[model samples]
Target: MKNFSTKALALVLWSVIFSFGGCAVMDKNIPGWSQYRNPDKVNELQLASSSIGEGNPVLLIHGFGASSYSWRHIIAPLAQKYRVITIDLKGFGESPKPRDDLYSVYEQARLVRNFILENDLQNVHIIGHSYGGGVALVTSVYLAASHPNLQNSLVLMDSIAYPQDLPDFVEVLATPGLGPLIIYAIPNTIQVKSLLKKVYFNDALIPQSAIDHYAGNLDKPNAKYATLTTARQMLPTDLQQFSNNYASLTIPTLIIWSKDDEIVPLEIGERLHADLPNSKMVVLNDVGHAIQEEQPSLLLPYLQQFLDAGTHRTAPNSK
Candidate 1:
């Protein structure tokens, strides 16, 4: 009887540790995590966000596996002229990554729309990269009827606006049992570096800081689960239906694509440009899918001109 009781206690202890361990949040100590975390919860989730400057609001969204850190280079400059807000989509960055299997693009867009409404952001411009671009597109569609002026313009950089084959990493993550094991086998730094190489046109330009920033807290089991779940549900069930709706969006849009973006491909950008009623597409040579990280300087003039044409010019006093 004594031996049985001891075994039962040991089993319970192991179960408790495993359950808690699997549910740990992404490490909040990642550089800039505290600096950008939003105190207010949008819906029920405490989203990580940074808001700076003051004018017509410009919200920036990062891609899959990225935090607000992805816009680190351009946020300051944009904030100088506009109220720049960058958010980590649910399950990414400092945002709460609940194991709740609800990381769809539509769900992400819903959160973004609420964030805009909750903050009372007006005459907003949305900029999204890769997966975030898809969210931005969906958000724009959602905003068209009720808050047209609020979401006035859009800027998409190598965005995932249309259906396409999944990237190698995405495919691997979307796999059932084997996916998690494969990703977990590699060290976080190594995994991040490997993925970065695939996105950046010139691997030589990849920095150590980038590797460290993106690799933050990925070792946690929740992070892995969130990533896997996101990959599996990256595309909506009615993607063609959604793509058909792109033509209905009349907002002024700037679609920037890298000539060497093997991930989403330049042809998709061309197709997206053709679909939108009012959109201008720019294709830059030699950059990869991460055009923001690679050639932000090249993007500034276009961004400044586009925003100046449509948005309020007066930037309010700094906060």
Candidate 2:
């Protein structure tokens, strides 16, 4: 019995050691992880973005934990007709992740507003996916209230506008102490691949290159912490409140959702459509949450039609 007890204790010690030590190993092996662990020199970080093509500006905002590269498949195609601007939100992609910053949707919306104003963009059309959709919605509402003439239209793809059950991984990251441990321990490759599987309808559709790209971003300093912070700040009340005045969004809106999306689900899309009086919802079959990457070909026509419709701005009912 004494021997057995000693062995058990030894095993427990090893387990605890590995739990913490694994993150250290990951930090070394994963490219970019070491560099991102340190705080950036600049206090106020500028969002990393690229503008391509010419015509009416269309800004593409990626979802949670995603960078502007998420729109790689569609940017060139859309740029053929309209100026396509893709941005990495402050905490994701190439954007600087400032420590202790609030990664809330409202904060993100403010950044979007700044981007538009600074660029002197007019009649801008916004397209966002997942969390990006939430940011886009908030941005639209703010524009409507402050500068109605500047806002033209919106496209929400599997957006997170309404309160819903958090995904298991997100729930884990949002937890207090355990969240940090998990975030630190998991390697970027493993985390990115696992998430890609969940976001893609067909596992086979996820390319290794895409996984590598996403993992590279995950390795950046403060990336994991930023993700955890964002998750914690994503309170349902906050999201719902931001979307409260969505009914007053009179701008032409298009909501595209994957019929079988396991992430945001179709119900959320339906709710967004119902809330926006002038919005139309298009359900894509056999696709998942990352519709922009997975099914861009199918999405192009709907986007073209919306953009061609031009500004159909009407005054929304007073809230």
Candidate 3:
């Protein structure tokens, strides 16, 4: 038995995993797809993705508790000038949510890295927000060391890169037993609206459709398991050690932060700017953690300028 308010709050606030568990089927047409095909593993899901436009490829990774739909406002504009790709990370949106414990930043990064390689995308740029920023950071590190020529630059928005205290809601939902119970017991439209309100600086700006879309996904089977598991692994043990790689990521990078971000403080963004040798930091006012959703129009110009400048930069270590 769970308290109604507690359950609703936990389910709504904590939304957002990792693991290369196993692939169910391998597409013959996709080279190297056979390698991930395994019947024993449960969560190595093929991501649900969409792409539009042409020219340089840009991948957008959404944050915790969000799906590709978060990019709804800006994808079209970006696609007009450059190829833009958006994905529902495993267990979020339309992607499969297995009753397994494979959700982590590392696992998500692996899937993202695989997506880049399988598609044979050249000089790709990744834009990640919040948790997705953590995933983008890991992915960039992996590519810089392994496939240096494939990835060109990185754009992180209020990302979780360094170790910090988990948000209060995240802590509540990450608690074993209680977390899963709350997620399944009281997920509904109201809870979804409550959650979005916290992310957006302007709650009135959130529309009815956004609530319906997110709430609908929470109602799906096994969605509880995925979100709970992801909360558990939100902060990996090797975070400090892993984050040390930030200094070596010399590829052009952009760090975007909201001055009013309540979820992740602006200080973290300043810290990230100090660490990344080849990075620029931009702070947007009157927005919360959900920069993309709140005012993407403010974000587009920086994105275009950064991408244009980075388009021809030699890949990391190309020299």
Candidate 4:
């Protein structure tokens, strides 16, 4: 009788684990999860995206754990003169959360390439921030090798291109066993506030609505799995390997960094500028990693200057 009871208890525990895990794995198929789906791979995941205006195309890619919403301040302003495209990379925002995808920089670059090809964009300019910046660099290299004329200009904002120490929380979250459990248990409000404090130079400038928006995404189904998977694949080694390709980038490149950025640091920006033969660096004062959100006004002039220069150079020569 004792042995039978023990076996029954074991069976019950196994059932609970399988039930929760199965729900997370199957969350991709449920309706009302995402409005945008990739037509090429109906079964696989697709990025949630929005494009506006017309002219030269500009693709905006956000940082790790962030979404297209990160570009909210700049998107519309830029769209007035250019076709601005913003996407929530897979597993970040409203995009599909597939359990099987690797969610690495290389994979994200592939997704960006596919998005450009599917949209039939030519000579698309790319603007990426932090993790997105790393993806932009990889994507630029891939395009230079695969489709030489597909890319125009490249802009990296406080991007993570060189090797550096990962944050303590990120290191902890990347651990094999503890990572999953901690991600699953992290409360939405607390997590949002903590991350904002670390990323923003002035935490007081972070609005409550912004906090709610970020926190709400974290509360989505299977968000924990997506977060953990992304964290696991975000190693500096993956980015550093592409550093050698910077010298080969002939397109007009812009490297923007906040002087006080604690995340990626200003030295990384200097290194990136040094490596890129045709690149220029601009350092903003009194801002942290979240430059777009914290100091959009300061960033606008540099973007305009770069885009205008590209436009002038690419303009048709009068007969």
Candidate 5:
């Protein structure tokens, strides 16, 4: 979770993939294969993603515990207007999880930049939700500073941008002795699954299959440690600072917040819009922090419009 410095910062602080047992740990009950069978031929899912359309480039960034799958609803429609790309940040999903102290927002930003460069993606638009929003902001600053003229637009969805300090809940959750145990029991997949009910305004938005898809990835070899270490070491305030650095960007920007968000409040979104010189804010009424899921129909068209039309317009009644 990432956000600006404020009382609501504590609120936003709250927040994968299904991989089978490894070659050695495969279940023995399966038909004829050995108990320990290779899960599949694939190991590390590259940063590059499946694409759609041939127009402008759009990168979709998923929030905490969510993999490329989180963009399921948006990708198809977004593909109608532009090339849509979704990636699993290093520590989450099928992506490579190198546990050699390699997890950080900068590292993730670097990886994404490298991917964009590797693919020669230009005039790219970043659309991120929650934790991914922080990464998107970092990517924008890094790309604007280093690559210049790469980022064309930014869409931050109920994200954590400016960080004041640790919230009381997180402080207690991160306590020394207890933190380890909590971290151990609640791995990436499980942590996300457990939080899903509260994360989405409507629990029905997340089906049982979705929960399974997320929790299943926790078994991936180094996945657990990668997520925990990143949290303990990579402070979000570091990423939030990147926003201040991007105040001069010429890229058109859009900020979307949910009025009823229990997680990141509208204040963070509003502050971000205020701080960013080239940006607009769209707040959705009757929704939570996870506005996309709580109200996908509300966000989808606006996103499609922004990407296709390159203009920001409120839904008039969004409030």
Candidate 6:
């Protein structure tokens, strides 16, 4: 009986150790446990999440060919203040690449709207980079007309909205019967290497691990078609100006641009600031378009400062 009792105590001790030392044990299998584990499993529409603190909310929308995973380094840190929601946009990253016939900018806006509705958030602030910025702009217009009560502030980070000539690579990709076929022929490795060169001002700054993750999904089954279609749909439009439909949005808008941005260029970001009545611009020097990724430390704090300022109070119909 004494031996049995002793063994029982030992068993309980081991159990306690297992519970308390979970991190140590899990550390051994961290890679398997990581969100990146099931790369084979479609990370579609996944929300890479962390607490947005106690306030309205802030949603971070990633750029083209990137996922919410791009914001992984940011999720926890930003959660310290406002609730941060970063989602893999439709047809990019892990989101479902449904047929273009079905998905439009309107539908993309709906994806955002649904996320907002499902979460039951109000007075939301959306920050978008690259194409995602355009989506946010379009979303602002839609919400102003349809769901004005759910006011949202726009933060455009080098978004492409106006009818600027498409980037040369995109232009080639858009050429009839030539782009898709050509893209299909190039091996993903070569394609990825080329894309990295074009997108980054300092290609050496982008890690191969990041490239692997992006390339892994970017060339997935339906992504190219969907991307082409979305681009084509918005090529000739005053999408940013559609917000003018709402008398005066009066929502505080912040547009940040990288003076050195090679991708979208500074002109578009500046133009967005010019068109939006209640908007301001911040141009960072020596930093290319993808400021969030290129210089997160310098970029994020500035954004946080914007959020914390009195600017958030600029509601159109204020109490």
lDDT of 6 by residue, 277-310 (tens): 6777888886666777766887887778777773
Q: Specify the highest-TM-score model's number.
A: 3
lDDT by residue for model 1 (7-82), tens: 5654454334333333212222222212212222358765788899988889999999988998888888888889
Give the lowest summed-lDDT range of ten residues in model 6.
24-33
| lDDT value, candidate 6, whole model | 0.64
Candidate with best lDDT: 3
lDDT of each residue in 48-143, candidate 3, tens digit only: 899999988999999888899999999999898889999998889988888766677877887888888778889898999999999899889878
Residue 30 of model 1 has an lDDT of 24
Each candidate: what lDDT?
A: 0.78, 0.78, 0.79, 0.76, 0.65, 0.64
Better of 3 and 5 by TM-score: 3
Ranking by TM-score: 3, 2, 1, 4, 5, 6
lDDT of model 1 at position 109: 80
* Residue pairs in clash, model 1: none
**Model 5 lDDT per residue over 156-233, tens place:** 998877764432223433344444455564444445554676577766676777777777766677866765555554
Where is the poorest 10-residue window by lDDT in model 2?
A: 24-33
lDDT of 4: 0.76
> 186 in model 1: Cα distance from truth in Å?
0.9
Candidate 4 local lDDT, 163-231, one digit each (tens): 676654465566666566555654565567667777899988898888899989988887777887777
Distance from true location, Cα of 113 in model 3, Å: 0.4
How many clashes show up in model 4?
0
CA RMSD per model (angstroms): 11.8, 9.3, 8.2, 10.6, 13.3, 17.7
For candidate 3, the clash count comes to: 7
